[model samples]
Target: MPIYSSDSDSYDVSSSSTRLFQRERPLHSILGGGRVADVLLWRKKNVSAAILLGLTVIWCLFEVFEYQFLTLLCHIAITVLLFIFIWTNGASLLNRSPPKIPEIILSASAFKQVAVTFHAELNRSLIVLYDIACGKDLTLFLLAIASLWILSVVGTYFSSLNLMYLGFVAIGTIPALYERYEHEVDYLAGKSNRDLRKLYKKFDSKVLNKIPRGPIKQKKSK
Candidate 1:
């Protein structure tokens, strides 16, 4: 009974496109937007950032007030309650018709999936190590290893609570700081890369290339 005009269709399309564009505005505007958001997915990343900040504050309070046992007790209670809830009412609370899956089959499938994921990740890690072994991006690889080693050493000197507090604070603050001063950070990063490359080139020319080659023992004739 009703006829739609071309103009009306075009208007509807344009309005929808405009709404989508507005919706797609970078999440980094509110938090760290780019690669960080991409890796975690934006909403989850924001929630994680919020949790990190909140926990950091709570950790500081606990440390300052010397309520370490209280923190442990709270964590244990929460864990126990979570497990009880999940075991008891979780199925009903899901509000879906009961799954037809056999429990053993489901568990086996889950284990298989976990094994596949573990294998994939192990292979990926080995590939990264192999690349590092081959001296690809050697400087960056060494820097990452050095950073991890330094963190391990530093962590040993701090109490678990203090280390956790620092970890959460760093997680929450660093991304936000980088997001706020992204252009400056990028500029500095670019400059550092250039300097590093120059240094690497100089080292290669003056030192690495000058190393005497080891004598190659030829294979004996059969």
Candidate 2:
């Protein structure tokens, strides 16, 4: 019985160790375990599908149909108002009740929380950018340059809205796909990371090490 229990414990440990990044927590928890994470991970499949469909429709309207935002907004508002007006007036003659519109009072706390989160993220990004600018981390500097260059190239081919739509689609799909095939993805990622490190070390030795630096001067004691 003791040997069997020990084998079971070993199995559990091995199983967990094999998980992507050897994460102690589940992917949902890593993604905040909130409604947003649920949608992204497709825990609520209907909601996720609806959101993606809505975004695709909007993207099509803007990109394929060349629809203006204000024009679409006004047209929707007009149609809604017309329907509501007809329902309210026609209900009296038809001996029926008018459509009830639900009140949508926005919460101040929700806005405040969103603002705080955005501010924190912005500050964190700025700090990273500052460090990259200061040449504090060579790897980060190269990564920043490469990312910006890629963005520039992509921008030349796609508009801002196209990029946003693509990003949303990626966010909606990538997490779920990764969660499903995490073991394989992690293995590939680990291999690529090791290869990148080797390349970086080689580059550092060949080029960076050859760069000359000025001697540091000592301050005189008063």
lDDT of each: 0.64, 0.81
Q: Where is the poorest 10-residue window by lDDT in model 2?
A: 1-10
- Per-residue CA lDDT of candidate 2, range 36-55, in tens? 88999999999999999999
The digit string of per-residue lDDT tens for model 1 on 121-220 reads 6998899778876777788687778888998999889988888777767766675566555445544454456577878899999999999999999999
Candidate 2 lDDT (Cα, 0 to 1): 0.81
Tell me, by TM-score, which candidate is best.
2
**Residue 91 accuracy (lDDT) in model 1:** 71
Best by lDDT: 2
lDDT of residue 118 for candidate 2: 84
**Candidate 1, after superposition: displacement of residue 69 in Å?**
4.5
Model 2 Cα shift for residue 146 (angstroms): 0.5
Candidate 1 RMSD to the real structure: 14.7
